[model samples]
Target: MPLLDAARAVRENAHAPYSRFKVGAALRTTTGAVFSGCNVENVAYPEGTCAEAGAIAAMVAAGETRIAEVAVIADSPSPVPPCGGCRQKLAEFADGDVVVTMATTAGQSATLTVAELLPGRFAADHMGNG
Candidate 1:
């Protein structure tokens, strides 16, 4: 549960004002390094950064590429899955079988693999190499 704990701890640091919907994400790299991030909203609305994206960026900045596990927590009635774009971002680094756990502050939770979250996801192989 360290991943979840990391996510929950970071959730408190979210910068959500307009939507007021805060989210936090934690990811474990294959090397066992853990990285966490919180959602940061922008005044421009859709230009905001997602918790998952932030975590992924942190992982990359730390020189880790493969994600071993993931957890995301949000203040919602039910476990909130990552946005469509976040799902793709996760897939870019994590394998299909990588587990992604979504949770609510109230303790409600759901789990799914990257493949389960995004079936028929577009992959780099889709683009033929020159």
Candidate 2:
């Protein structure tokens, strides 16, 4: 999809000097707007932001939430899945059914729902948001 293409394009802009592992994410809001982000690494260590988090920040800054779809791209031997933290972050804005497309620079990909990536999510119902 176009969102996967966008994520692939943004992967080139990642500032990953430390790990040299660039990652990019594209998030599609329920309103049909697409936002993209590239990972930014810091010398300080461990505080670097994930591409998914950055994209979510941009989406929220634009007053959009409820990610209907997500795409993440990285140059890895296999499709790079988001870290545990990112999966949770994604779950915060996306439901169990939201698609999460993980891709490699080689164009290989795997698509799974958010629940498939992170089952038993720590979401609103657990917090009584219902």
Off by over 4 Å in 1: none
Model 1 per-residue lDDT at 26: 99
- Give the winner by lDDT: 1
For each candidate, what is the lDDT?
Answer: 0.96, 0.92
Backbone clash pairs for candidate 2 read: none
Per-model TM against the reference: 0.97, 0.95
Compared with the true structure, what per-residue lDDT tens digits does model 2 show for residues 1-130? 6999999888899999999999999999999999999999999988899999999999999999889999999989998888999999999899899999999988799999999999887877777895
Q: Tell me, what's the RMSD of every candidate?
A: 1.3, 1.1
Q: How does model 1 fare in lDDT?
A: 0.96
Q: Residue 93 in model 1: shift from native, Å?
A: 0.3
Show the lowest summed lDDT stretch of 10 residues, model 1.
Answer: 121-130
